[model samples]
Target: MSAALPHAPARALNNLVTQGWNQLARVYNSPVLQRVAYQPPQDEIIEQLRIAGIRRIADVGCGTGILASRIQQELAPDLIYGCDASVGMLRQAQARSDQVRWINRQAENLGLDDGAVDAVVSTHAFHFFDHAPALTEFHRILSPGGLLAIVLNNPRSRFARLLQPTMVQGLAYFPPPDEMRTLVEAAGFRITEQRPVRRPIPDQLVPDILTVARRG
Candidate 1:
């Protein structure tokens, strides 16, 4: 189990995450970052979404709406909601396209009705969330059998593990595959698939794990 943060530390961590992302919002979509961090797992995420036959979807921690925009163009989901806590990030996302409904909200309180979406996709953003509450919220907003895809950094190397704690200062947590499966299942979801995202270059230092689940 992941260690629980005391109230003060948790609040501080939340502020740090929000502030840091807000600062990065402008340059977050730059090509360099996209190539290294964002683009690689996109195809797989979209494929999973397609396989799930999603019509209405929510992109939690959507960040600049890159994936959401792609889904809008490719899958052409009936409704697309892009949600993020950072106003700056949401602003950038809003600029991408008017088609997506941009909502300024955190993952734990998405402000959507119960069972409101067919699928929820969050990439490279789950680490910054309060996992248990966020997972519970994800389950709450998803319909029975609703699909969920989460892409996040799950460091495995000794070097990566050593650095992980100091890097995010308790603001982010990357649970390994076994722990992640437990967390997801505990939230009332059945694990459908779990795999490592193939990156352009090998990235053993900080690998991305994709976990897909269906609400039971």
Candidate 2:
């Protein structure tokens, strides 16, 4: 259940990287995170590898490297890359014990070799991006039949509707699950599945969708 909490107070940034991290990394430490985010259980990641056969993953919009840190611990993909436009968030992701590789990049320009990753995963960060450019990057990075899973915060939920007036209007473009499938397909992804999960995020009505898609 998403609790729909408002964004938090400002963070102190020592550099541009810190400034970028402030834009989204705040979620990692926010007390409000409990409701809106569904951190995939470690077990599901293992299963994703077995079920979907993902080898390497590029986590776009990887704020604070929270999920990547855990993915490094659990899946330890042959290679894992966390990409974000925020230098601050990249710094935070890189600072996490040096195991995670952080990239100071945007969703539109991955700067990676074509077909470099087996999968791309994002958590609650897509709404900030220009969808067409970001999806183009997703297609560019994936090998044929590669997977893309984006877990976005759902605004249709009670908490999101209540909090929308303040959380940011950009989210209006990111609709609920079925509609999202239509978007994904329009972006050239063959959606394989759409699974919903309930996460406990304080002050939000939280229902998350882990949309599974494959490159044509």
Candidate with the greatest TM-score versus the true structure = 1
Off by over 4 Å in 2: 1-27, 30-38, 41-46, 166-172, 198-204
RMSD from true fold, candidate 2 = 7.7
Clashes of 1: 0
Distance from true location, Cα of 39 in model 1, Å: 1.0
TM-scores, all models, native as reference: 0.90, 0.78
Q: Write the residue-wise lDDT of candidate 2 on 1-216 in tens digits.
A: 012222222222213333545675645656445323445422344456557767688888777777777778876677888777665566567777366667766677777889999888887677666677788889998999888878775667765666575346332256678787887888789998777654344434465567778998
lDDT of each: 0.84, 0.67
Off by over 4 Å in 1: 1-12, 158-168
Task: Give me the displacement of residue 1 in model 1, in angstroms.
Answer: 36
Worst 10 residues of 2 by lDDT: 1-10
For model 1, give the 10-residue run with minimal summed lDDT: 1-10
